[model samples]
Structure formats: C-alpha cells, structure tokens
Target chain A: MFHLIKKDLIIQKHLLLLYLIMLTIFIYFQNSSVFIIVLISAIMTLNSFYYDDFFNAHKLMNALPFTRKELVSAKFIGIIVFTSATMIVFMIVSSILNGGIVLLAWQWIVFSLALAMFYGALYIPLIYKLANQNLISIFLFIYVVTAILIPSILDYINEYFPNIILFFYHLPDSQLYSLLLLISVIFYLLSWRLSIKIYEEKEL
Target chain B: MSNILEVDGLRKVYAKSQFVLKDIDFSIPYGSIVGFIGENGAGKTTTMGAILGTLKKDRGAITIFGKKVDVTKPKIREDIGVVFDDMNFSSHLNVDQLAKVMKNIYQQWDNDKYNHYIQLFSLPKKQKIAGFSRGMSMKLSIAVALSHGAKLLILDEATAGLDPVARDDILEVFIDFVKDKDHAIFLSSHITSDIEKIADELIFIKNGEIILKVNKDELLHNYAIVQCRSDTFHEINEDDVLAYITKDEMLNVLVSNKHGLPRGCQISDFTIDDITLLLMKGENNERTHS
Candidate 1:
C-alpha cells in the first residue's frame, strides 16, 4: 500500500511541485488563506486520481498482489498525507511571514482540513465509478456549475426561510465543528466501502 | 508431472453483447510452454483476464499451483507474473523507479535479476518509459515479470510488436525460464511461428471456445494436410477429418490421423500457421458423440 502511494507521488512529481509553488504564491500574496489552502489541497487530491485515470494505473495495480480494499485505503491515506504535508508547509511559511501562528491561521487550518475531507468523501467514489475520461469531464462540469450556483441558492433560502438560517446561526461553534467532523468521517468511510465494492465488480 | 495452472468450465458473457466464453478449459504442466493461439476477439484476452482475476468469471474454477485462486487474498498473485499487450505501467516512471515500486509489491523481488534483465535488454535506467519504443516497452515489461520469483508467467501477445530478432531474444528468455522444471509459461499470440519454435503444447481457440488442444510433437508428427479431388475427399472417413476447405476444385483437408488417408491422396507438409488457417477457415466434421 505504501508502494502504491509512493507510485502516485512519483508519477505526479512535477504537478506536485507546481502545486507547491502555487500555494506559496497564494500564501505570500493573497489574503484569502483559508480558501486557497483548501482549494490547493482539494486540487492535489483530485490530481492524483486524475493521473490514475489517465494512465490506467489502477488496472495495473489490480493485477499486483494487492486487494481492492488495500487500494482504496491507499488513496484515502494518500489524501491525508498530502493534506497534512501541505498544511505543515503552509503553517511554517505563514508563521515566518507573520510573527507566529495567528488565531486566524488555526481557523483556516481546521476549515481546510474539513473541506479536504468533504471533497475526498464525495469524489473518491465518483472516480472509481466514472473512471472514463468523458464521464469525468461531465462530472467536473456539473460540480463547477453547482459550486457557482450554490451561494446564490443559499442566499435565496436565507431570504425566504429565515427560520432555517436562525437555526444554523444559533448552533454552538464547538457543536458545528464536531458535527462536521463526524459527518465527514462517516461519509468518507462509506465512500471507501462503496469504492471497494465497485472496484471488485469492475472488469479491468 | 503436475500441472501448474488448470482452468475448468470457465464461462463469461458480455452484458451489452452476444459474445460468450463457452466452457473454456486448458492447463499448463510444469516446465512446459503452452501456446494459446487464436484470432482477434477469440476470447484469448478474456480467458487470461479471468485467470488473473482481473475479470470476474461467471462459473468455473481456476487452480494455480494446485490451489483455488482467490482474488481478494492476492497472496497467490505473488507467484504469478503477467504482461498484457499494451503497456500497463505509468509513463512518468523510469525503469529504476518501477523497480522500487515492484520491490515493495512483490515479496521475493530480486534486484540483481532485474538489473541483469535491464542490462541484457539494453534498457536505459533513467529514461522514462513513456518515450520507449514498442519493443523496448515489451522488453521492460518482461524484465519486470522475470525479476520477481514468479513460478508461472502468463504473457498475452508478449511478442506482438517486436521485430524478429527481438522476438527471438525474448523467446530464448522464455525457454530459459522453464528450465528448472518448476516454472511454466502460458503464452498467447497470433504469431504461430513463435509458438512452433518454443511451445510444448498448443491450444487453439475460436469464438470463445477451445477448438483444439494437443501436444506440439503430436501435432507435428500425427497431423497431416491432405490435398485431393472432390471424389477422393468424399471417400475419406469423417472421423479423420478435423477441418477442410475447397479451393478451385481441389480439396485441402486437415486430418488428425495421417495413416487414415485414402490411397492416391497427396500428403503435404504443413506448419502451425497452415494448421491454424485451415482450422479457422475450414469446416469441422460434426462429432457423432458429445
């Protein structure tokens, strides 16, 4: 499993370097650190899956002495590894640039971790099911459109349904964070199981 | 001698097509090379996929090393090395990097053997596999397969893209691999000459069925291609006729028993290619019993 993770890194070494450079620029120049950090982490995770799809590496790995469950676990572990490493690098850079780890930095770190987890839970199963290039493009198109329209949809809901907004607004910060973490972890585990089932039933 | 691999009653059907693999069965004895010969879409690749557990088998048993194969366990795969027609490795990885990956994946990966094959094949260590020519990519795949302590080597079209010289070299390596009497090779190819050169047994498949399986020596010594006029062809017993095709008023027949041929019929020497063509294009004599 570690070898599989290392293979993904080796194949995507150039893209990883470019991602790091982009994150450094975003941290030094952009003020929206939280959003940038989460976006970069998500892109990195997605890029690994994308490369696997492009090269048909999953089929190769399936022929090796590794189970479908192990393959799925490797991807999840890979995402965590990438997310942790990126956070550590950004934290160090942010601390050096700004005197020390600021209160906002902690918020961004937690938020970014949550965002990465959410995307990982959602996209990993999709990657396994829709391994084709055309299907993946269609999925990305729908996701981008939804991401663009979600804010306006939320605003309309808030305007028309004040009670829903009030309910969420009244929730305690600690409770919200705990709820988000719980949902993300459960969703991720479910996705992992789904991916394994799909992969096992798949015909090379 | 014991068989290294045995497949029985293996069946598969495509959901979107009418094609089906019908009770495919064969085996590879230890220290012998079994050649799988078939045209395109003849279920050769599909059978290999089923054996490797990359494709699910609807009904059948595949026993490797005398034990039933379980894809989930994957421990059995450690002893089998497979190479498909197309390159399966990532393009970004160099030869050395791929070695690192395999070393972790296979429990008995031999770095010295890998390096030996790499040097023997004259493959560059640092160059990415993406830029490799077809022959080079094939050699690299073979190198990787042989590096691990694989008791059985399953190669599908392993010599498809190589020149004659390179194909000969690879075939030699295959011959050497099975020298220990514990190793076996199940090779599938459209190139019958290569099979003739190295195969101990031959299996012919068509339309997802095993049409014939015979020892290479038995095929060469006992099988006969007879040319005769229509009347003499009709005089021969149907049981002796494997397949026959008529061309320009002359009948060319493939018979399993050469001594069964009628007097005055002309017997001609034939190669594996000739036998394959006749079997594929000619009509088979209907069997009286199942």
Candidate 2:
C-alpha cells in the first residue's frame, strides 16, 4: 500500500509542481491571505484523486499480489497523504510570504482537519463508483454551480433571517469550526466505508 | 500431477442485457499450456478476470492447487502471474523504481530472475515504462510476471500487437516456463497459430460461451475439412459433421471425425484457425435458430 501511494506521488509529481506554481502566482498577484491560499491548494490538490491513475495504472495495480482491499485502502491512504502534504506545503509557503505563520495555530488545526474531511467526503465514493473520469467531470460541474449558488444562498439567508444569523455568529469561532469539522469527519467516514463496500464488489 | 486450475460452471452476466460468460468449465493439468481461443468479445477476458477474483461471477467455483478458491480471500494472487494487453506501470517511474515497487508487492519476487529476463528480453533498465515500445513493455510485463515464481501464468491478449520476432521470443519464454511440469499456463489469444505451436489443450469460446474443449493433438488428428460437390452435400448428416459452408458448386465441410468422411468427399487437415472458424460458424447458426 505504501508502495502504491509512493508510485502515485511519483507519477503526479509534475502535476503537483504545476499546481503549486499556479497557486503561488495567484497569491503573489492577488494579495490573498494564507487561509485563502490554503483553500485553493486544498481544492487543487484533491485533483490527485482524478489524475494519479489518469492513464489506467490501476490495471497494473490489479496485476500485483495485493488484493483489491489493499489496493482500495492504498487509494484512500493516498488521499490522506495528499491532503496532509498539501497542508504542509501550504504552511511553508504561507510562512515564507508573511515572515511568520499568519494562520492562528487553532485556525490551522481546524482548517487542515476540515479540508481533509471535506475532500474525503466528496472524493472517496465518487472514485469508488465511477472512478476518475466520470467523477472528475461530475465533481467539476457540481463544484462550479455550487460555488455560485452557495454564496447567493448564504446572502439570501442573512438578508431574510437576520436573527438566525446573529445567533449563529454569536457562537465562538472555535466551537463553530469544531462542529463543522465533526460533521465533515462523519461524512468522510461514511464515504470511506461506502467506497470500501462498493469497491469490494467492483469488477476490475 | 493434479490439475493446477479447475473452473466449474462459471457464469457472468453484466447489467446491460447480455451474459459475458455462460457456463464456462475447463481444467488445466500441471505444466500444460492451455490456449484460450476466442473471438474479440468472446468472454475470454471475463473468464480470466473471474478466476483472478477481479470480477464477480454469477455462478461458478474455481479450485487452484486443490483448494476451493474464495475469490475474496487473500494470497490466491500470490501463485498467479497475469499480463494484460494494456500496460499499467506509472509513467514517471523508470525500470529501477518499478522493480523496487514490484519487489515489495510480490513476496517471491526474484531480483536475479527479473534482471536476467530483462537482459534476455533486451529491456532498458534505466528507461521509464512510458518510453517503452509496445513489444518492450510486454517483455517487461512478462519479466515481472515470471520473476515472482508463479505456478500459473494467465495472459490476456499479451501478444496481440507484437511483431513476429518478439512474439516468437515470448513463445520461447513460455515454452521454457512449462519445461518444469509443476507450472501451468492459461494464455488467451485470437491468434490461432500461436496456440497451434505451443498449446497442449485448446478451449474455444464464442458469444460468451464455451463451444468446445479439445486436446490439441486429438483435435488436429480427428478433425478435417471435406470438400464435396453441392449436389452430394445432402448425403452428409449433421451429427457426424461439425460445420460447413456452401459456396456455389462446392460444399466445404468441417467434420469432427476424419475416419468417417462422406462418400466421394475429399479430406484435408484443418489448422487451428480453420477449426475456430468452423466452431464460430456452428455457434452463429445455433444462435440464429437455424
């Protein structure tokens, strides 16, 4: 499983570099905060789910002595690695830019945990069902539409229900972040288990 | 020696209205090269996939090394080496990296054997698999498959795109693999000639069903093409014959038994390809309700 993950990273090293360079350029030009930069890197880094075996490397993985369970586990663990590494890289770059880690220590913890859970919740089952190709297309389409609709929906709710917004805003940021992180983790585990079940019965 | 691999009543059906495999059954004795011959979409890969536990079977059972194989069980893959037409290695990793990776995956992986086959096959050790030619990649695959000391080699169209020389080299390697009677090979190919030169048993598949399982020597000796005038073709009954096609004045018949040729019929030996064509014809006619 370690070998499988390592191989994936090796294959996608170029893509990783491209993503980092693009984000660095965006950050340099836009004067984006470290949080925003981390968010972008988190999104881009999740593309590893779609691109690592973009050329059908699973064919080779299936041929190996490892069972399908191990292979699927490797893929899930690879996501974890990607998310963690992206966060580390994000922190290093952020620190370099601000001459210090501008992200509050607690915020960094919550953000990293949220990012991992968020991507895992969405990407795992998608890859398990349709694999990289169809999942990538569907994810992109949903992400784009949802990106637009989410803000407008939030603005609408804030405008129409000021009392509810005020009540939620009064909660400590730490508590709110933790709540979201808990929800995300639950979603992530659910997706992971669902993926495992689906992949177990899948025909290679 | 006992049969190395036995499949009984194997069947697979996809959701999209067709059975990919229907009641497939065959057994390969240890060291025998069983040639799996079929048309392009004739369930060869599906059957192999089931045996490897990569695909679920609708109904069937497989036994390897005299133990009932549980498809979901671990380590069944340890004794088998599989090669598919499509290359699966990461493009960025060169041969050295692949070697390290495979070494960890296959418990019995022999570096000496891998290096030996690499040199014998003239594979570049430093080059990335992405840069490999089709033949070179296949050679590399064969090397990896062989390195792990697999008792059974299951190949799915691995020789499809190779030039004659490369094909011959691979054939020779297969011959070497079966030199020890403990080893067995189940090789799937549309190319009949490759099977003719090497296979001990030939299994014919058509439209997702097993048409015939034949011993290679017996198949070659017992079957023949009999040509007769169209007028006399009616004298031959269906039971004694396998299949035949009539063209104008000539009736070309493929018979199962060469000893019982129809009166005034001229008999000639049939190649493996000819037998497969006749089987296809028989299957097609059966399917059409003719």
Candidate 3:
C-alpha cells in the first residue's frame, strides 16, 4: 500500500512542481500572509488527487487487483502525505519571506481543515457517480463557491458574536491547537470511511 | 472436464430499452481457450465485464473453479487476469513504475515472468505508457495480465486493431498460456480467423443473446452451410437449423447437424464468421416474425 502511494505521488511530481511555482509567484509580491498561501496550497494539493481520478486515472485504479477499500485507503493516505509535504514547504517559504517564525492563525487552521474535510466529502460522491469525465467543472464550481462562502460566513459570525472570536483567540495556545487537531483527525477518518463505502458501490 | 467457470441466468438491463445482456449462460473447462464471437453491439464486452464483476448485472450468478464469486472480495480477482482493447494504464507511469505498482496489487505476481514477457514482447521499460503505440500498449497489458499467475484470462477484443504480426504475437502468447492444463481463457473478439487459430471452444452471441455454444471440434464437424433454393429451404424442419440467411436465389441454412440436411441440398464448410453472420440474421428474422 505504501509503495502504491509512493508510485502515485511519483507520477504526479511534475504537477506538484508546477503548483509550487505558481503558489510561490502568487505569494512573492503580496504581503506575507501565511493563511492565504497555506489555504491555497492545501486546496491545490487535495484537488490534484481529485482531478487525476476525475480525468482518466480511474480505469488504472480499477484494473489493478486492489480492492476498492485499498484504493480508497491509498488515495486518502496519499492526500495526507501530499498535504503535509505541501504545508511544510509553504511554512518554510512564508517564514523566509516574512523574516521570522510567523505562525498560522487559528482561523487559518480552521479554514484549511474544513476545506480538506469538505473536499474529501464532496469528491467521493461525485467521483463514484460521475467518474472523472466531469471532474474539472464540478470541482471548480465547488471550490470557487466554498472559497467565497466560507470567509463571508466566518466574517458574519465574527460580527454577530465578537466574544466567540475572542474566546478562540484567547484560548490557551496548546488547548486550541489540540482541539483543532482532534477535529481534523476525526474529519479525515470519517472522510476515509465514507469514500470507501461510496467506492464499493461504484460501477467500474 | 469440469466447468472452470459457469454463468447462469445472467442479465443486465440498462436504462432506456437497452438490454446489454440477457440470460447469458455458458461454462468452460479448466484448460479450454473459449472464443466469444459477436458483432459490435452483441454485448461481448458487457458479458466479460459482468463475469469480472466490473459491470453490474440485473440478476445472475457467476462461479469460477466451483467457488462462488464475491465481487467485494478482491481475492476472487487474484485468480483471473483481464486485458481490454483500450489502454487502462495511467499514461504518466513508465513500465518499471507500473510493475512496482502491480507487484503490490497481485499476491501471485512473478517479477521474473513479468520481465520476461516484457522483454519477449519487446516493450520499452523506461517509456511512459501514453507514449507507446496502440500495439505496444496492448502488449504491455498482456504482459501485466500474464505477470500475475492467474489461472483464467479474460480478453475483450484483445486483437481488434493490431497489424497481422502483432495479432499473431498475441495469439502465440495465448497459445502458451493454455499449455498448462490448469489454465483457461475467455477471449472475446470479432476476428474469427484469430479465434479459429487459438480457441478450443466457440460461443456465438448475437444481439445480447447467446445463439450457440459448442466444442470447437464438434462445431467444426457438425456445422455446415446448406445451399438450396429459398422455397426448398422451407422443407427443412426449423428444429434442426441453427440459422439461415437468404439471398435472391440461394438460401444458406446453418444446421447443427449436417446429416439431417435434405439430400438435394449442397453442403459447404462454415467458418466461425459465417456462423456468426447467419446467426445474427436468424436472430433478426426471429424478432421480425414475433
């Protein structure tokens, strides 16, 4: 399974390089906002996996003797591995450009986690039902809509209950980090399970 | 010989009026290479997909080696290998990368055999699959299928577009596959001459229905085209005839038993193609009459 994941990553190395260059260029001129780069990086990383299967990679996955569960597991694991790598690179670049140990905001953390969770959730069903043929248009539509709606919703919430923002802002750094981490872990696991179930019923 | 694979009451009804396959039943022995012959829309590919559990069936049962198939269980797939006409390999991966990926997929994968077939087929190991020609891609697929020690192989139009040489090379590989008495193959193709060269049994399907299934030797000895006037052809009993095609003056009847043909009828050898065409026509005639 690890080898399968490694092989998949190797196949998409060029895409990764292109994404890194594009993100680096997008961040260079703008004021160093770690949140923006990290958010975009995470979304791009996750979307790469989605696009591959959405386009033409499905038959390759199916023709292998692997179970749908193994394929699903490998994909989920690949996303995690890819996302962690992308996050590390993003942090390194942001710190170099900002000239300090600039940390990610809790909002940034929450936003990234939610995006990843939602990506996996929506991608699983769409892929199972539509295959990869319509992956781009649907993924773009969802990504744009979510990108627009999420920040607006967060802003509205901040306005309605200023204390809610203060509470998250003032919570002990370690406790807040742990809570977000726990939620992220739970969402990832749930996404993995849901993807497996949907893939099992998908016609080849 | 015991049946190595059995499919009973197999049916797949798609949306609209499409019946991709309906009531398909057949069995093959442990070592037989059975040729599944049909036209473009005759559901040959669909049946193979159903047997492999890749396509959904409305209702049916498929068993291999006397064991029931559980589609959710990947272990059932370990015993079989499939090669489709279209390339299923991801274009980005090189042959070496693909081999490593496949090693983890099939527990019975033989690296030595895989490499041997790759070399034998003369496929470039370092090139991406997308860069290869159609014939090369098919050769790679055949290599992957054979690399795993699968007892049964299912090929869908595996020889459709190849030049004669490439097709012959594939045929040679298939001949070697069934050399061991424990192996069997379900080869679906429109190329009847290729089928004639390699298959031990022939299954003729037309318009989503199986019209005939018989051993190659029996089919060869029994099937004959009886040519006579269209009016005289009606004198033969419908029960004895498998299929009949009518031209302006000649009525070519495909009979299961040549011995039962009328004495005045002229008999000629029937190739697999002839049999398939006659059956297809007969099926349309049956629909027209009904």
Error of 2 at A179 (Å): 2.1
For every model shown, what is its TM-score relative to the native structure?
0.93, 0.86, 0.86
Clashing pairs in 1: none
The per-residue C-alpha lDDT of model 3 at residue A19 equals 68
Per-residue lDDT over B108-189 for candidate 3, one digit per residue giving the tens place of the 0 to 100 score: 9899999999998888999887798877887888888898888899898788777898889889989988887799999988
Better of 1 and 3 by TM-score: 1
Q: What is the alpha-carbon lDDT for the whole of candidate 2?
A: 0.75
Best by lDDT: 1
Q: What does candidate 3 score on TM?
A: 0.86
What clash pairs does model 3 have? Answer: A54-A132
* lDDT over C-alpha atoms for residue B186 of model 1: 98
DockQ of each: 0.67, 0.42, 0.42
Candidate that scores best on DockQ: 1
A1-204: candidate 2 lDDT, tens digit per residue:
787677566656657777687656655664433344334434454455555457565655665666677776776676567656665666677677768874446666666567556765676676678765666667656655665476798899899998887977998988888887888778877877787788787777
Best by TM-score: 1
Off by over 4 Å in 1: A96-107, A134-158, A162-166, B285-290
lDDT of 1 at A156: 94
TM-score of chain A of each: 0.83, 0.79, 0.73
